[model samples]
Target chain A: MAAISVELFAYPWDILEATPERFLDHCVALGVTRAHVTVSYHSGKFLLPRNRSVRVYFPEPGALYFQPDAAAWAGGLAQPVSRLAGSGWLERLARGAAERSIELSAWAVFFHNSALGAAYPDLAVQNAFGDVYPFALCPSHEAVRDHAAALCRSVAALGIFSGVDLETIGYLGYFHGHHHEVTAIPLGMAEKFLLSLCFCPACRAACGSAGVDAESLAAAVRGLLDRRMQSDDASGGQDEEAEHVATLLVACPALAALIRLRMETVTALVKRLSVEAGSAKLAAFTSSFVGSPSNIWMEGVSPTDVGELVECFHLLAYAPDVAQVNSELVFFLALTSDPARVNLTLNLGLPLTTSFSQAAAKVEYALRQGVRRFSFFNYGFLGEARLRWIGDLARIARGDSR
Target chain B: MTELRAGVIGHGYTGKLHASAWLANPHAALTAVADSDASRLAGLPAGVRGYSAYEQLLADDLDAVSICLPTHLHAEATLEALARGKHVLLEKPIADNLRDARRMLMAAKAKGLTFYVGMTHRFYPELREAKAQIDAGAIGEIVAANDCVLEHLGFLNVPQWYLEKKFAGGGAALTSGVHLVDRLRWFLGDDVRAVAGRAGNSYFGADVEDSGQMFLYFRSGLSAQITFAFMREEHPLVCDLQVIGTRGSLTVHTWQSYELWNNSGRQRKVFYTQEPHPAKVQAGIAGEVEEFRASIVEGRTPWPSAEESTRAVQAILAYYESAATGRLIEIGDLHAV
Candidate 1:
C-alpha cells in the first residue's frame, strides 16, 4: 500500500497562547506526523487625537488596536503572533517531525483584514448606508489585496510551514457591500444599495467591459421594492392580508452569463493569490450542499447549476483536495454520484457519533470508488471519550497497526 | 343592529384554523362552511350550516367570506366572492402568477370590495416587539438581517395544486419562502428593490424547487440573506431576525422572543414573550369586512385597496424573475412586462 500519512491541521485560535513545548508534546502524543500552525495577530481600535497629524476611527469593538497617527494607518503593521509563537514551537515541532518524519503546513485566513478594518477606518469597506464594516475588506480593492499578499508572504517565509491555507475571501453574498455585517434595510432601499457597488473605478471599468448595466439593474430592484410595499399596503399592512406582488423576469441566458463573469473574477483572484504565495497547491472547504444544484441555502441556483459551478472551479485548476465536501450522509451519496469530472481527494468529515467501524466502512467504500485519502476534521474536538479512534487513525496512518 | 353573518369556503386545514380564530372572537357570527368534499364538511356545530357548493353557501344571508381554497382555485373563488359583494380573506400567495394576482386585484378594486391576504406570521408577538423597537430607533440605522427556515420534508405533502404550475406559480420559494420574504420586508420597513436567488430540488425530484437562498437589497441600503429549505429533522420552526444598527442590535428568535443588544453600553436585554393579540387578528378581518360592508352600505372603497395587492403580486413576480433568470432583477420592470 502507498505510505499512509496522518497530517494534522491546527487552527490559529487554538494555539494563540500555547508554548512551543506544549504543542510539540501534544503533536507527539496524537501521532501527528505533520502539523499545520496558524498565526493570527490583530489590534483593537485606535484613538485619533485631532491635530496629531493623523485621523482614525474605530469601526469594530474588539480584536484590533492601533495608535492613531500617520505611522499607524499607513504602513503601520503589527507583528504577527504566529511569527512569535511559531518561532519557538516550530523549531521544537520541526525537530520532533524530523525525528518522526512528519510534514507541516501553515494555515491562514486569507484576504481577511478584520483587524485592519477595526483599527483603521480608512481601510474598512464602506457600505452605501454610510456604515463601515470592520470585519471584512473588499477583495476588489487594491490596498486590501496588497495587504493580503504581504501577510501571505510573511507566513510563507516562516520556513517551518510546508504550505499555507487561505480562508474567507469574497464569499460574502452580493448585498454585503463594504461591511462585513449583514443588515436589514427596507426593500425600497435596494436601488440605493446597488449604486454603492462598482464605485471603485476598476470595478466600474470591469462592469463596463462585461456590459453590466448597473444603473438599470438598480432601478429594477427599486421598482420591485416599490411594488412589494404597495402590495403590502393594499393588504392593509396586515400579516394575513394576501397581496400579489409583481415579478420582473429576466432572460435566463443573460443571468447565466452575469453569474459566470462574477465567478470568473473571484476565481481568477484566488488563483493569482495562490500562485503568488508559491503555494500553488490549494484546497477549498465548501459546505457539501451550497450554491447551484444543491442550493441548501435556497440561493435560487439549481443542482445542475451547482455542477456547472464545480466544473468552473475545476476549469480554474482547483484540486479536489481544495473542494472539501460537507453534508449529511444522504446528500454526500448524491454528490458522489454526479457525472461531473473531478480528480481531487474527497474529504468526508461527519458528526462524531460515527463509530470507527462505521468510519472504516465508509473509508473502504470511498476507496473502492477511487478515493485515495481521508481525514477526520479535528482530533482535539473529539475529546477523550469515544474519541480513542483517533489513535486507531494514527495507527492506520502509520500502516503498522490497522 | 344585526350582527353580520360570515361563511368560510373550503373548510380544510387553513379553513379550520380561521374558523377557530373567528369562533373565539365575538366580532362576527360563523354562519356556514362550504366544501366540495362531503366527508370534510360532514360535521358541523349546532348553529352553523354546511354546504357542498360555494354558490349555495353564498346564497345564505352572510355578509363576508374567507376563501381558503387550493392554490389553483384562489382567483376564481375569490372573484366569485368579490363579485357577490362579500368581503374576503384570501390565503397567500395571492395567486399562482402575476397575471392571476393582477386580475384578482383589479376585480376586487372594480367592485370596491375588501380583499385581504393571510400572512399570519406578522401577528407573532416577538416580531411585533422587534418592529416596535426598530421603529423607536433603538437599533439605530438598520444595516443587515438574515432569515432562515429549515425542514426535512415540509413540501412532500403539498397538494396537487402546488405541483401544477397552473396552480402554484413557483415552488417552495413561492409557498414557504414567501413568508420569510414578506416578514423581512415588513421588519426592514422598506421594499425589496432587487433580489438574487438560487433554488433547486435536491431531496425531491419534483420540477419545483425544494430549497432556495435569496439575497435581498433594500431601498435603504440594507442587505439581507433569506434561506428556506426542506432539509432538517429536529430543529424547531425558527423564523428569526437579526438586525444590526449603529446604536444597537435586535434579534427575534423563533418569531416569538426578542433580544436587544445596545452597542454603546454593551448590554443585552431580553424581552418576555407575549400572547398573540386576538384584537390584531380580529382587526384585520374586521377591517376587511367593514370595507366590503361599507362599500355596499355607503358605496366607498377600502383602505387596503386592490392597488396594494397589485404591487405585492408584482413583487412576488420579481422574485420569480430573479430566481429563474439568475440575475438581480428590478421589481418595477415587471410593470411593463
Candidate 2:
C-alpha cells in the first residue's frame, strides 16, 4: 500500500490550555504531519477529557480564533474574535507548529454562526413557517456569501496557513442544534428535507430567478409538514431515506428544481471562496449534521460538484465498525469522480471507534481502496489510550506495523 | 361522576394488568376493551365490550381509558380518546418521544380531562414504603442512590415492535430503565442536572439496546447510577434500589421487600412480602387504577402527572443521546425533537 498523509483536527483552546509545544509535539510523535486547527467556528459545549486543565470548554459563539484584517470586513458581517485570539494565542500556536514543521491549516466554519445570525436576523435562514433559525445563516444572501469569502481571504492573508478547511459553507437545516432544543417529533427524511428547505427572501428570489414558483413550493411544504406534525405518523426508517426523497421529488418537481438551485448556489459559493484563498489549498468537508455525501444535496451540497472545486474532500467516517465505515466510504466514493481526492476523517474515540484494530482496519481498507489520506478528528476529546491508537494507526498507514 | 366508565386498550401483558385493575377498582366500571388480536380479546369479561380496533372502542361511551398500547401507539390512541373528552391513564414512558407526550398532555388539558401516566412501579409496596420512610426523615439528608433492573424481558420474548426504535423509542433504556429513572426522580426530586450513559445491544442482536447504564448528577449535590439489562433468563432477575443518606440508608426490591439501617449499619427495619411477584405487581397496578379513578371523581391531578411523566421520558431520551454521542448531556438541554 502507498504511504498515507495524516492530519489531526484541533482547536485553539485545546492547544492554548494544554500549551502548544506539548500538544504539537504529541501530534508529531503520533505521525500527524498537518493540524487542521480551528480558526473561526460556531458555539458548542466541548468536553476536553484529555486536556491538562478545563474539563469542559464552551467556545465563544461564532468567534474567529485569529485576528482578522479590518479590510476583510469592509462590506461583510462583523468579525467576532475570541479574547485569547486577540491576546496572540493563534500566533503562538502557529509559531509552535512551524517550529515542528507541522503544516497548520485554518479550519473555518461559515454560515453556521448563531452570533452572526442573531446580529442579522434578516440574513438568517427562514423556514417555511416564517420562523427564523438564528443558528444558521442563509447562504443565498449576498452579504453572507461575501462574509464567508472574506473569512477565507482573511485567513489566507494571515500567511501562516497551508490550506483552509471550509465547513458549513452551504445551508444548515432546521434540526441544527439549538440550546435546550426539543424537536422530539420523529421527523422522516422527507419531512426533514421540507423543514430544512430555506424560504428566506434571498432563497425565494434565487428560485424565482430560476423560473420556479417559490411561494407555491413554500405553501406545499407548510401543508405537508403541518399534516405530519398534527398527525400521529411514525417516522420512516433510515433505509427509506432515498425512497422518501424520491417520492417527494416525484410528487413535487418544483421542489426538485428548487433543490437543484440550492446545490448550484452552494457550489458557486465554494468556488468563489476557493478563489479568495490566495495560494492556500482550499478543502471542503462533507456535510456533518444535515446529510451525508450521498444525500448532501439536502444540505444544498452536491458532493461531486464541491469535490471538483476543492483540493481535498473530507468525508466524516464517524461509524462504529469497519462495515459501517465501509458503507459510508463506498457511498461517498461512488459519488465522486476522483476517489484519491477524498480524505477519510474518523473519530479516535468512542461512539465512533473503540480499539486500534477497529480503527486500523478502516484505515487499511481505505488504503487498499486507493485512499492515501486520513484525518483523525479532535485532538482535545481523546484520552491517552485513544491518542496511542492514533499513533499505531499512523504506523499502519505508512506500511510500518512496528 | 359517581362511577367512571373505563376501557383498556391493547390486550398485551400490560393491557391485561390494566383490565384487571379497572375491574378491581370499586369506583370504576370495566366497560370496553380493544385488541388487535382476536385471541387476546377472547376472554373479555361479561358485559365488557370487546373490539379488535381501538378506534371502535373509542366510539363507545367511556369516561376514561387505560391506554396500555405499545410505546408508538400511545400518542395516537391517547390523543383520539382525549379528543372524545375521555380521561387518559397512559402507561409509563408517556409516549415514544416528548413531542407526542406534550401533545397528549395539552389535548387532555384543553378538554379538562384527567391525564395520568401509570407508573405502577411507584405503587409497589416496598418502593412506596421506602418513599414514605425517606419523607418521614427515616433516611436523613439523602446523598446518593443506585437503581438497577435486570430481567429476561427483552427482544426474544417481547412484542417485535419493542426491538425497533421507531416503535419503542429505545430498548432497555426507554422501556424498563425509564421506570428506575422515574423512581429516582421521584425519590430525589426533579433535580437531575446532567447525565452520562452507555447503551448497546450486547445480547439478542436486536436493533435496540438490551443493556444500558446511566450516571445522573443532581443539582442538589446528589448523584445516582441507574442500570437496566434485558438479558437472558439464566441471568438472575433483579429490580433493586439502594439509597444512602447521612443518617441512614435503605434498600428496596420491587414487589418483594425492603430493609432500612442506621449509620452504624444496624438493621432498623425490614419488610418482606409473602405474596408472589405477579400478584404484587397486579396489586400495584390496581393501586394506580384506584388513584386514576379518584383523581377523576375528585377533580384532582393524578400522582404522576403528565409533566412528571414527560420528565422521565426526557431523562431517558437524554440517556440515549449521551450513549450515542459518548458525552455528558445536561438534562436542561433536553427538549422535544
Candidate 3:
C-alpha cells in the first residue's frame, strides 16, 4: 500500500525563505523525508502584504484573493485564476531539499477565506436559511470546486512539490474562530448542523439526480432546527443530543437522504480535486473529531471508495490527553474501512492543544497499528524550548535515539 | 371621495391576503372581487360582489384595483385597470415579463393614476424605525450590509403558478427576493450599479430557483450581500441583516431586534424588541394598504414609487441574468422608465 513514510509540516516563510541550508540540515538531522510547506494562508484583507522578502507562497498566480470572477456562479466554463507571481522559493527549496533527499509538499488550505468571501459573497457557503457564512466557500458549488482544483493544479504544476496536504475540504460548523465572534443567541449542535446544511440549487440538483427529494429533506431539517431554536430547553448534554439526532434521522427519511448526500457531496469533491492534482500525492486532512467510529466520517469525511483516488488519509490526532488519543485511536482503528490509507497527524503545539509526550505516545500508538508515516502539525509555531521536541519526535519515529 | 371603491383581482392565497388588507383599509371599500377559481371566489363576504373575469370588475364602479392574479396575467389586469381610468395597486414585479411591466407602467403614467407596488416589507414597524435610524445616521457612515430572508417551500403550499416559468417569471428570487432588493435600495438610497449573483433551484426541483446569493454593488461605493431562499422549515425565517458602518455595525438579527456593536467587542447594545413575528404575513399589510389609499387620496406616487419598484425588479432580474451568464450584469440593461 502507498503511504507517506515521514513528513514535517513547515511554512514557506519560515522553513526555506531566510536560511534554506540550515532548514534542510535540521531536516536531515531529524531524519524527515518531506517538508509539508504552507502554500497559502488566510487574512482579514484581500491580497497578501505586498513586497515581502519572498512571494510567501500566495494564491495560484492571478488568483488575487476574491478577485471577481465571472465563473463564481455555476454554468458554462469555470475561469480559474491562472496568474502566479514568481518568488522562486518553491523551486529553490525543492532543489536545496533534493540535495538532502528530502521532498517538498504544498500544504494547501482550501475553502476557508475571509477576504474572498467578504469581497465576493457569491462564492461563500449559504445555509438552508440563506445566511451566507463568509468564512467558507461551499464545495458543492462548481465555482469553489473548480477554484480548489485549479489551486492544486497550479501548485502541482510548479513540479517542486511531491505531495499536497488538503485541509478544510469538508463543511465547517458553528465555531469558525473569527475575531470577536459573539453569537448572542444560543444554537444547539443540531441547530448549527442544520444551519450548515447547504440546500443550494446545485446541491439540490445533485440530490435530485440521486432520487432524493431535496426539498422535503431541507424542510425536515429546517423544522427540527426551528423547534430546537424556539424551545427554551438549553440542555447541551452530548449523549442526549446524539440520541435525539438519531431519533430525528430515523423519523425523517428526507433528512437521512440529505445526510447521506452531504457525505456523497464531500467525497465527490475530493475525487474531483484528487483527479485534478496531476503528478502529486493527494492526502486529505481529517479533523481531530473524537467519537464513535461513524462520526469520524461525517461532514464530507471520505467514504471507503475515496481511497481509490486519494493517496493517504491524514487523521489529525490533536488531543492533549494520551488517554483521549488512545480512545479515539482505538475507535479510528476499528472504524477505518480502509486501514492501508490511514496515517496519524499529531499536533506538537498550537494554543498548547497537545504536549510533546502525548504527541510522541500517539505516534508510537499509530506505529503499533502498522502505520508507516508520521506528519507533525507544523514547524516555526513552537518556541525555541518547545521546538526541540521536533528533533526527539523525528528521532523516535526514525528509530534512532541519537 | 366616496370611499374610492377597490377590488382584488386574484383570489389565490396572496389575492385573499390582499383582500383582507383591502378590507382593513377604512378609506377603501371592498366593493367587488374577481377570480377564475369559483371555489376561491365563493369564500368572499356577503356584500362583496364576485366576477369570473377581472375585466368585468374594471367595468364596474371600481375606482382602483389590486392586480394579484397569476403573475403572467398581472400586466393584463394592471393595464386594463389603468386604461379604464382606475388607479392600481399591483403585487410584485409589475408583470412576469418586461414588455408587460412597461405597458402597465406606461398605462398608469398616461392615466396619472396612483400605481403602488406592494412592498409590504417597507411597512414593517421595526424596519421603518431601522430605516429612520439609518437615515438619521444612527450607525454613522455605511460600510456594507448583509441581509438574508430564507424560508421553506415545503411549508409554503406553493401554488403551481409559483413554479411555472411563464407565470412566476423566475422562482424564489422573483417571488421573494424583490422585497430584500427593494429594502436595500431604500435603505442605502443608492441605485445598484452592477450585480454578481449565484442562484439555483437546488432543493425545490422547480423551474423557479428556491435558493440564491446576490451581491449588489452600489454606485456610491457601498456594497450589500443578499441571500434569499424558500428552503427553511423548523428554524425561524432568517431575516438577519447586518449593516456595517465606519463607526459601528448595526445588526437586526433573527427577526427579533436590532443592535449596534463596534469593531471592538466593547459598547454592545440591545434595542427594544417588536413582537408578532416579522415573518407573519399579516404583520405589516394593513400599513401597506393604508399607504396605497393615502397615495390615491393625496394624488401622489407611493413611498416606493412605481419606478423604484421597477428598479427593484430590474436589479433582481439582472441578478438572475448574472447567475445565468456567470457575468457581473449591469442593472442598467434591465432598468427602464
Q: Write one digit per residue (lDDT tens) for candidate 1, span A93-195.
A: 4544555555666555543455555655555544323345565555555666655565555555545556554444442333333434443433322222232
User: Which whole-number lDDT from 0 to 100 does residue B247 have in model 2?
Assistant: 85
lDDT of 1: 0.52
Which sequence of candidate numbers ranks them by lDDT, best first?
A: 2, 3, 1
| Residue B325 alpha-carbon offset, candidate 1, angstroms | 2.1
Who wins the lDDT comparison?
2
lDDT for residue A32 in candidate 2, whole number 0-100: 93
Best by TM-score: 2
Better of 2 and 3 by TM-score: 2
Deviation from native of the Cα of residue A229 in model 3, angstroms: 2.3
Alpha-carbon RMSD to native, per candidate: 29.3, 27.2, 26.7
Residue lDDT tens for model 2, A122-201: 99999999989998999999999999888998898898898999888888886466778776567776787788899999
Per-model fnat list: 0.00, 0.00, 0.00
Report lDDT per candidate.
0.52, 0.81, 0.68
Task: Give the runs in model 3 whose Cα sits over 4 Å from its true position.
Answer: A1-4, A44-85, A237-240, A288-296, A337-339, A350-354, B1-337
The first chain of model 1 has a TM-score of 0.59
